[model samples]
Target chain A: MICGRTPDELIRDIEGFHGFVAPGLVIGAFMVDLAREHIGQNTEADAVVETRHCLPDAVQILTPCTVGNGWLKIADLDKFALTLYDRHTFAGFRVWLDLNKAKAHPNVYNWFMGLVSKKDLPKEILIPAIFDAGRDILSVKPVTVRAEFAKREKKSKIAVCPACNEAYAAAQGTPCLACQGKDYYHTGS
Target chain B: MICGRTPDELIRDIEGFHGFVAPGLVIGAFMVDLAREHIGQNTEADAVVETRHCLPDAVQILTPCTVGNGWLKIADLDKFALTLYDRHTFAGFRVWLDLNKAKAHPNVYNWFMGLVSKKDLPKEILIPAIFDAGRDILSVKPVTVRAEFAKREKKSKIAVCPACNEAYAAAQGTPCLACQGKDYYHTGS
Candidate 1:
């Protein structure tokens, strides 16, 4: 069994980071728990999150990784999924919120089935209920990522366009798109 | 001068897309105008917005590019800048908000100097003021991007972890970080 502080304590801490308690926060907490289980508490671990939502907050709060440090990468896949990778070893795990399995939990089922709409429901009741449901719905698995992605791209040549005076990556045979260029044509002149 | 619908009509439309009228929205509108000036209204043009704030909404409203179509790529540099790229020609323009010049406009200066905080400011005063300031502050320039970043990365090998049953990219000699990994170490064993 996954062990930690009480669910109430976790939710309270999560609430402090996130403005208010909601289903997403609960789900995020559960996801972090699973990630910690698989990866251990390695400060050097990096995170690749699929969506730009509550899950990233959970990762930032519960894990050692963060966006400021460039350890957390947002893939913006628009899915509620994340991958925790070890930079040195390249070992990682991808965790996804399995909607179907999530629905198996009573609270999640009600939320999905429309028994409880998000707007009308009180968070006090909803927060803990989602926490209970999260265990059944989350899927955690292992994988590896390319070394190239972990390494940040080197800065490319940047130039200012004389006409419009904006900065852009310098490229051969390409004129500034702003002042003198057609939509489909590649020739600079 | 940018010729288009009346300023009232434009502001009304912009207000509709963005929930509230603020300096960012006005800046976004001006940025869109600059983008349109450089690159004609071609449906194939894509946009790379540097920040995840109001500028994106402006690009989405005024230009042919959008996030849904996968044409709007967000660089998330956290700067008040944007780049509009023509997919066919690979030409682009970078636009930045010039705070010094923008402050030349009275309203913009007030907002920047913290005389007018965003929260309590009324839309009627705030909207037009920002539009005026944006005209003064925004700088348009030209640039070119490498072909590699323009083209999306091809789908790589994705594998499911046997231990936890989550999907991950397959890399040689790297175990799943979830099952076995330490913090901050670089080598995968």
Candidate 2:
């Protein structure tokens, strides 16, 4: 074949094909379908695939050299780190696949990715070693929660959405009782 | 979204697709493009895509898991047996891209595919992989080769159709022949 670049180059290029592959599972497909529902195409296996709007940010698998960093950096990619183990080897591409699936979960993908950082590995070889032992697909799930979250009081006990802390609403009870007592009149007090 | 089938049914039905997340790089894109190309809606990506038509016998990756063997198989997808390196992974997918490119340049892609197949972990992996890897819309060129063939018999030396491998005739001996011993024929054979 009249190739203009090396095979290595081709492999790397494929990794750069962005805005194409989706990360969500069934929900992802539903979203894709929803996004394209009006278009009315994409019905067959070979339909013109229209990407979903505003889903999880894309992720990238770093090369082998950067793998030793232990914990992966959660950044613009909006990713999470995860682990996978099967009957056979521990090291292989399976690690990346598992992390990828998790990242798509929204609830857990990012949460788990936060846990596994450089601190987890002593040798920092876990990442590369796994990718190095390449398997077709990662056939494992995310890490299990060892300890259950403690039950806490709810909005019924006290209304929240306090003033100033727009990110989190305060529990309501005292004062104006509009925004968890954070009314403008009660704000200064 | 109001999906046609229940989530459980969708999970059990679609061949590949997890809940809402998509997996793999370019795989989904490739399938989407394939659907479009087949239906004649593929347009925009044509500038970057280098495609060719090929008729290959469809092969299966997994089977009944009983007495009957699978129709096709691809050795582990990694480039090497040591670790799960992204650089080493996806060998099976690469073969498909190679095959489509080969089909375009009938004389060349095949010979080139054969060259790389020699180094593959297991010889058997080549067939299934070459099919599974599928076609590619290369962002750029990745390979080029120079082949020099030396033919012994004059009757066999012909200008053949590179796409279809059809043979044709050229000039007769002495009238256009520069030498008495060496000659070239134009034959589809």
Q: Which 10 consecutive positions of candidate 1 chain A have the poorest summed lDDT?
A: A180-189
Model 1: residues >4 Å from true position, as ranges? A1-189, B1-18, B113-116, B119-123, B171-189
DockQ of each: 0.04, 0.01
Write model 1 residue lDDT over A110-163, tens digit each, in one string: 553346766766676666668667678888777676676666544345455565
Error of 1 at A76 (Å): 6.9
Model 2, B40-61: lDDT tens digits are: 3322111111111110001100
RMSD for each model, in Å, please?
12.7, 32.2
Candidate 2: stretches off by over 4 Å? A1-23, A41-189, B1-189
Please give the CA lDDT of all the candidate structures. 0.61, 0.22
Give the best candidate by TM-score.
Answer: 1
